[model samples]
Target: MTTLLALSDDFGSQLGKGIGAIALYAIVGLVLVLLGFYAIDWTTPGKLSDLVRTGKPNAVVVTSAGLISMAFIIVVAINNSDSDLTAGLITALVYGLVGIVVQVLAIRILEWATRIDIGTLIQSETYSPASLVVAAAHLALGLIIAVSIS
Candidate 1:
């Protein structure tokens, strides 16, 4: 009994530092995602004008999907922890929703100002598959963030 208690105590003592390290890794992962977003924004073939005119980009879809996934994983993973689950979940959801709305709204407003038909572009076969995949992945990430992190 004494040995078991001692072992547990030793493990507990080191747990905080280990967990903090893991949190750091998560932050790093987030930064990488952000960086990737920026990279695509600058390097992609389609012009911002094109996206605005059409209000449709596979990039938006891919990122949205990834974020959705993240929200779910983060929320569900942390529910039973000592963390303030409510605050975390709320913040993640709000951030994701705001991001999605902003992207969509920007596209819509731009298309409106340019007098372009967004619906037509969306229905076109020239839509990007790769960018859409990225958007889907982000949405999945967002879902994980919503459900698991809390």
Candidate 2:
């Protein structure tokens, strides 16, 4: 138990160093998801804006795809390593979950900065900066994990 705690602490510190960059990466991924919705909205049957407004398939589809893709990529990246995959994968799962919380905070900041109520801009091509910030943080974390293990 002590060994496990020590290892986790060591790893967490390394990850914490790159938290900002990781958030940026997460935000980028979020933006991509939003963009997917934009494309689907234009090409699909119903109005994308309406679906997002109602929080229907639009929100579900976009968020799910982004998360699923992130999970797969993270898991694969971690698992393929010769080093500690469990630690890496678990760290990513936890870290990514926390980043969502970070994004919630980012949303408020973005609202203040841009004066564009994020709720209203849900389905549009224009995504708020919150998503970008979160993605940057994620990108940083992912790089750290990938490099640390390698």
Candidate 3:
């Protein structure tokens, strides 16, 4: 009975530590994802949030794709990380932010090379097929980053 009690106490303490680590990582991850959202919003023309609020499908597609891409990169970074909780969170943040930047740059480069006004397409009230191209670019870039991190 005494041995069981001691084991329970040890387990409780370890559980507390694990919970704390998870909370810290979660908060950091959320912030990084928000940052990514803002970055993508800035790269594109018009207010993405406003468009989404008004039920624009093109805006929804771009924003949803960006969020998913950001989340995927962060998840991969967290999984591949083996450092202490804080260090791992920082590493994930770096990977996430860099992924966002690269994704934005890739879109801009594509816009220039292909002569497609990706920004205009994203902002259009009509459902633009070009929006899918932009969304796919982000997803492809995100997959590349996620694989590189892992």
- Number of the top lDDT candidate: 3
Which stretches of candidate 2 lie above 4 Å from their native place?
Answer: 1-50, 53-82, 123-150
lDDT of each: 0.46, 0.45, 0.79
lDDT of 1 by residue, 1-150 (tens): 355434665697578866774575465446534543444344334543355456565434543454445434433433423345345445544454444444444433444565545344333446655455344434543553344334
Worst 10 residues of 2 by lDDT: 98-107
Total clashes, candidate 1?
A: 59
Per-residue lDDT of model 3, residues 94-130, tens digit only: 7767767876787678667778776677667789887
Q: What is the TM-score of each candidate against the true structure?
A: 0.35, 0.32, 0.86
- RMSD to the true structure for each prediction, in A, is 12.5, 15.1, 2.7
**By TM-score, is 2 or 3 better?**
3
Query: Per-residue error at 72 for model 3, in Å?
Result: 1.2
lDDT of candidate model 3 versus the reference: 0.79
Per-residue lDDT tens digits of candidate 2, residues 1-150? Answer: 355434664787778756754564465445544543444344333564675567653344444433443444344433443344345445554544443444334334544575644344445455455545434433444344334333
Off by over 4 Å in 1: 1-7, 45-150
Task: Report the backbone clash tally of model 3.
Answer: 0
Backbone clashes counted, model 2: 23
